[model samples]
Target: MGPRFFGYRDRVQDELVREGHQVECVDDRPSETVWFKSLAKISYHFTDRIILHYAEDLAERIAKEDYNMVLYLGGMSFCFTHRQFSLIRKSSNARFVAYLWDAFVNCKRFGQCRDLFDDIYSFEVKDCERYDLKLRPLFYSNTYRSIPLGSEGYFDYDACFIGSVHQYTKFKTVSSIVKELEAQGYRVFKYYFMPSRVAELWCKLTHRCYRGQVFQYESLNTTQVVEVYTRSKAVIDSPQNGQNGLTMRTLETLGARRKLITANEDVMHYDFAQYGDVLVWNSDSDGISGFMRSPYECPPESVLDSYSIKTFVQTLLGEAPPYRGYHNDDCCNETEDAS
Candidate 1:
């Protein structure tokens, strides 16, 4: 699950693998999908019999290894299911943990796997307080950014939405709104589905809806996605209530020195929105879209530059304790009383 799935397992797992851990991933790849081209099509759910076979195989393989920690980075619903977590717990002594993106959005798996985890790792501090169980806070792998262009380029677009067609009403609604926004002279970009290069080439040949005037569907690799972020004036981010709240793109937007107009409620808890830097942008709920003519102005250059990966990673790793760095132009220092 690379650029297709938002906040994928690749870069994060690569970090682990680079750290010299023998990491084996039951990743977003299908059990049988060994080749890259195999991931080009739609998803196929694993049958129970197949899943059990894999589970037993996984259990046996893991049992042989000497791992002290088992981290579930939002892939727990698949890799470490309730049944498998239990099976592994019974057979393995590894500390099982999950890093959930959406602890509250639309929660069904909470009860099933709550006890299975030794700890739930997350970035949103408020969510930890909201949950019934006491969970330890691990700086979620969100303090990273991808700017489409590294240097200055005024390839201006109003906003861009870089995500796939998810099976959620709110997400669909957001897509529609983005299209409407584009229709009104605001350039927007997103994928109809998590598009593959092969599919993209097909669309270009067909002259289908992929080439819509207002909305541009780009199948750029993760690198191009960041360039889109940097080139565009802003990125339209929508936070799914409990699931993966405070969309990672929001942080990325800051990192790219781009503005973010997000309807995500959890983002309000962040200094990004609370401070003058990021806007409390809810087109549907906030009523700001009702009368608000133009989008909130982008923050100054150094404003978001300050919220860079360098500082974010440093702050998260305890290299530098969480210190509120105030920015007068579009930043959280105004919202939070920092001494």
Candidate 2:
């Protein structure tokens, strides 16, 4: 499988291979070289069709292959038209399935080819409710289990959140929460997409909002993230505004068997909450100290196994697994409450 962000595609390939299924992976992205990528990033602002040529080229390659299943993961900025989808379908006897992890923001672009896919799955609960799509929570790889925990002295912070920030209140809420935790004598190591002071000034000068960052540092890679997860006592989760579903950080915390401090109170309604693995804190609420002082309880092995990417891939391939942990109905009441 081709490498992608979070190594999610790599995890999928590993799981399918472990199940003894022969899988061939293909990448749809173009311009992997530094110079080409720089050019693409610059040209993207001038024309929406900057990536169209790449997509059409990839479609031609996909059309030449015959497979039983063609799965697309996380359609970020890729543009695929109906004609291209039709060509892909005609070329392969494979079932076209697209799994979108970022359905909330990318819906408009990804939804364009929704009818072309045989099966569509989204991580967002509201998207499923509104668009009649299947709801699947994001998964975590079992590899996290290899990281030994309980080494408190190794970390400088009690909790850490390494993710992108934005202009929205969700990210602003995170900054506030981090300060609150610090005031309560808890240490927090927070990182966002803000790269430099120059960039921040540029945004202000141009009157363009830095969409997902405040102060900038280079984002962590997979190895660096796993290292951080191993050292930290808990990971903080702050969902983007209007997104009711759990982020991958939630599942990653579960995989690492670490504690979770989240702004999403809806998580309290899920079965995983029954295990005491998570502490839900809202910006409007109190009790930051109590929750921080609470112990991290290890969830049952069954619970961990249920949410593994292995089981998720099996379910995707039409296998009935014993543990299908969270469902759309489980979050229905929470959704209603939020509305």
Candidate 3:
């Protein structure tokens, strides 16, 4: 797994260890200095050189080890070149597998490295059909499952939103929703996180929507996110533009047994949404007040279990069948789901 900003890599590794597997965790990008990470977002030349060097080092190390499988999680395009992938493939006899929690649009380089894997999976339905990949949704860690649901009238806030503000559109949409929720007399908790001060300054200079906006620089850990969800009756989700897959937050909300207020209309087609566990909000925040006033309906226990990290790992390792419910053909015309 790549070292993600939210520490999901470590969480996935820990889950593997819990499953009784002797695992070797590799950081695809070990140079995690602030400047190096920031440059990776803007400079393809610099990023490519770093990845190339890392691949050579990794290939040499992999040649010395004997493993049954090489489970790669995300970052195929951003972290590896075709030649680099070939080098690693030549070094190890392990079955190479990849699981892309991100969409193809976000990882444009995925096509170049797609054929190198023995088995590949994606969270987005569109990507699965387009690339002939298996369909799988992102999973919620066990932390969310352990959260005790609050009794009626026990919530500290009516709703909560905790996510990064990556673009101006998401910032504007979230800000408007929060304002509307407050106007309706619902207590709301918001944590709009920006990656760094550098990003904040760049947005301030370029996007008028970000000027004077209050953004938290530090990201909330999984425990903190669970705490916020515990205190809130419902959680808000605004996906990035053109992304059509259920996000980690969406599954986490389900695991926490909380109501979800999302911008993704495609969510209505999911099994969990059939029970009224999710609300698809529009630009004007229509039906939000009534939705928030309604009681949250829990999906079936089987549906919830299918989305746990344990199930996800099992499916990735070919130990269990992939969860099947909604087909991508049913929602081909739909705009997008949450990211």
Q: Give candidate 2's whole-model lDDT.
A: 0.69
Q: In candidate 1, what are the lDDT values of residues 246-268, reduced to their tens digit?
A: 45666677666566666664455
TM-score of each: 0.62, 0.80, 0.91
Candidate 2's TM-score reads: 0.80
RMSD in Å for candidate 1, one decimal? 8.1
| lDDT for position 296 in model 1 | 41
- Of the two candidates 1 and 3, the one with more favorable TM-score, higher being better, is 3
lDDT of 3 by residue, 204-295 (tens): 99988888678898888877899999999999887777776887888899999999988877777678888876888787767887788787
As for lDDT, the candidate ahead, 1 or 2, is 2
Ranked candidates (TM-score, high to low): 3, 2, 1
lDDT of 2 by residue, 94-132 (tens): 788777777545645567778877877777766766776
Q: Rate the local accuracy (lDDT) of all candidates.
A: 0.51, 0.69, 0.80
Pull out the clashing pairs in model 2.
165-212, 165-213, 194-215, 194-216, 195-216
- For every model shown, the clashing-pair count is 13, 5, 0
